[model samples]
Target chain A: MGSSIAANQLVWHHDLTGQVLDPASLNLFWFELTEGAYGQIHRVKAIVEIVDGSAWQLSFNQGEDPMETELPVERWLSGRPDRPSQIEVVAGVDFDPIGVTAACRVAGSPMRYYSIIKPSCGSSHENRGYFLYSWQL
Target chain B: MKIAVISCIHGNYEALNAVLSDIDDHKVEQIYCLGDLVGYGPHPNAVVEMVRSLNIPTVQGCWDEDIIEGLNACECSYPSILAEQRGKLAHTWTDQEIHPETREFLAQLPMTLRVDNLAFVHGSPNNQHEYLLPEIDAFTAMERVLGTGADVLFCGHTHVPYVRDLSDGLVKVQVKRSGVSETATQIHVAPLKRIINAGSVGEPRHGRPNATYVIYDPESAEVKLREVEYDYPKTCAAIIDKGLPAIFAWRLARGLEYAERAEDPTHICER
Candidate 1:
């Protein structure tokens, strides 16, 4: 009810296509947004890790002319085969769901779907362990 | 009136009998069976026969649909290969052993039932295979109930019972389209809509062997989760005697889930 994320709460706000995630992006790391029992949201901090591929990248578009942002080292030494890149964090995606990109509003907005809070996820079944680059608010 | 809802009996006649008796004792005016009358238990025929004879209003569960339409499990239905194999063994057995009339009953059962302001389904309104877990995403959860157009939705399949309230909220979405004007959609969820899971009567996985069901009072909008102790050991024995996997019995005695995928809260069933 308040604007503060409660203890043990994780939240995510994303508005993209089919939901705009590239199949080549490998593991979107969903647990970062859906752990904890509180389901509240004060802030979001995350790190995107490149688990595989020489050209580790994050793409916003997927059509013919795509906007691809390549990680520095992962691209420089790409296709070496001997060097498989696995850069963690800003090198990848610290999932700031409510990042600067959104045409977004939280408290002041008349409607709020900013984050889908999963309030009943404290059980062992839902806990798939933290498998990411960053998860500190 | 006090209404009793039972789900996922899974062919355990003993647990079903006990829970039915408990419902009788509670003096419920109406009873609802949220399908899964067969599968992974000792007495599919007897269980189906009893429910049929009792004339309980039931909605088709995922297992119920599977017996009629063949196995249509979605992602994470079996967490591991061992679990999948075990699930298939049970499925094959249920498919072969299920009586034609019983299968027919399951086929005739509606995927959803609406009574006054309450709607009932074996899983989510979307599909019987979809799990309306207590921790399911708030947006998806609200959408499920809204789709039902009901004040409350009763569902089961997770084998663990719980309730969630979706009340007084704004659902905003900014849709991204290709070569078109950007549009935003909003739905105002007001008052309250509830999702009540009746848990499992036969193969409970909430860390106990007691059969669970739900008693809801439509007038007061109150819900009472009923866990009734039955002769589960007899059901366990019958599981082994009837040639079901022995692990099913072992897990039944402990109320541990056997081969059923009850984990993965974020999994939204594609089916």
Candidate 2:
């Protein structure tokens, strides 16, 4: 997951190789629900950028909106149906079990969360989603 | 007799107005509502009052039951966790905003209403939350119609409209005794049965923000699906202003379910 970062954003994208995205993982979605339940997965990817002011921003994908991006990381996402609104990252302390922390402000409510290493196992495949830093609340 | 049927009018007074106008154009004698008169939109009481004023024979929907008796049908709400959260928000908003008289009106509605051989129900004969998807097996479809003892069953709840014809139905009965060999008898229904889904009058989910219903002609046995275009943006604005879940507005604008669609078509609603 970290391999796509633009260098200084968090060193080099972590060389966590050959990770296949799970269709049921958490993410934002927009459109008609497919027979598989989740909608079209165009160029959608979870992007959590630790920005200039020691804050991080999360979007399913970086889109036209300059303030916030419309993207989902998994099958389920919280926010507007078409795309998530701009969530102001007010604070990010050193979160445990992962690299960073973040409090996202959505619809005038502060949702505080941090990163965690979620390991999911299946019979035939085991794909890991890792980054230089991931947070959970 | 030509009858007009509507269902899943989740409190959008604007869409209800448009559908009623279209039904008037069809010159139908009777108008039957397949329930879900309230929930997920701006004006619940206004929509109920309109239906009451029109004297539309209505059945109780899952949302109506939830508001009156409480939200117990967890499975009927949504499939996604995020969608479930939004469903709770909408349900809570509706429960808080619903008037006492409107609640009484919804509580008095029957689950199933029959007129001669034509039956009306919100979802299926089994329950309001059970979805009779268009692609369900033929035997199950025939069973739903036969359960009502009706040649034709008119229903809604899936929000997507469809028509299914149950033809060439055969049932075999077998009896076995300890001292006798198994005996079997076959019975067949001569006339083909039909399941007509009225779709949704307010919150539609057929890929467009237009209301849908069905006009049934008893003489010719013809079911015509009607789609009506309304000022949906008005309802969308109301959803945001009413302090309901904002996701409902986005979904409503696109003719999607306010929360989520039915996940399991075969699983009967246990709630």
The top-ranked prediction according to DockQ is 2
Identify the runs in model 1 with alpha carbons over 4 angstroms from their true place: A1-137, B173-179, B182-184, B262-271
- Backbone clashes in model 2: 17
lDDT of 1 by residue, B22-71 (tens): 99999999999898988899799999999999899999988888888886
Give the number of the best model, judged by TM-score.
2
**Candidate 1 - CAPRI tier?**
incorrect
Residue pair clashes in candidate 1 = A5-A42, A17-A20, A46-A94, A47-A93, A47-A94, A48-A93, A48-A94
Kindly list the per-residue Cα lDDT of model 2 for residues B102-137, writing each as its tens digit: 999999999999999999999899888788889988
Residue B191 error, candidate 2, Å: 1.9
**Deviating ranges (above 4 Å) for candidate 2:** A1-44, A47-137, B75-77, B173-190
